[model samples]
Target: MNIKLIVLFFSLYCLFFVASILFPIDFNWYNSLHKPSYTPSGKTIGIIWAFLYSFISLSVCIVVSMVESFKKAKWFFILFIINYIFNQLFSFFQFEQKNILLATIDCGFVSVTAILLAITAYKHSKTSFILLIPYSLWSIFATYLNYNIYLLNI
Candidate 1:
């Protein structure tokens, strides 16, 4: 394993995680919202995100390490950037701005971009592609949850 590459990917994930923390979700406001009964508790959400981010970092490291061409590497980074932006924006919209509709849209973007990353990574590293499944599924679930929140709150 390339230690430097692992560090880079993990560092990038940490940056987003820290930024989300800095923005800080307003739990009071979030709790006030009309959430679905299936909505996970705050602690559960945190635990899941922690695991997902760690897996995402590992998957990205594997994909980045396996890319055989500069062009493919560039495309991978581009997709990563888009996914990162959408991931962060979901928190910004949901927690900071308290907009469930925009958050739902952001979550949708995250899900789409996540699957794209998985598909693209499939050509380079099957392990990387398989590793992304959980994140993609969780993103889809989160999108559904967010959409439901939007509907119920509307």
Candidate 2:
């Protein structure tokens, strides 16, 4: 039962990760954007995202299992789900159609999610907070990237 639950949650996380990859399938996607030379490559982004998702899944699983306060993880779970979906959807606003404004707005939401998750994790499970540090940092970076893209395109 426990193993199945773990598998289920991990599977869901991977589904979003894979969706992100395909959702940005247009090679022209990169070509359209005037990116910083320091911007990560597709392969680098893929690997980092995959690794981050794995950590997020494991940390959430641990928190859900160990935390006694259903109220705590419950709200955090909702926010986390919203954040994950928004993260995936940003690709649509960005690559498929190239709406830099919408993409920047989406990144704003992602930034909020990161802070909310960080606070919730810190309150509910100290160890979980560590797991999300990378996520928080990435959100900050992504916000800057999105802003730069919007400025460069428009």
Best by TM-score, which number? 1
Q: Worst lDDT window (10 residues) for model 2? A: 16-25
**Tens-digit lDDT string for candidate 2 (1-154):** 5986578667867776655667756776676668777788888877887777776776687678776776757878888888887888788877776778888899889888977887887867788889888988888888898788778777
What lDDT does candidate 2 reach at residue 30? 73
TM-scores for candidates 1 onward, in order: 0.93, 0.87
Model 1 C-alpha lDDT per residue in residues 26-118, reported as the tens digit of each score:
878888989899999999998998888888887878876777766877766789789988998887888878888999999999999999988
Colliding residue pairs in candidate 2: none
lDDT leader: 1
lDDT of 2: 0.78
Q: Which whole-number lDDT from 0 to 100 does residue 64 have in model 2? A: 80
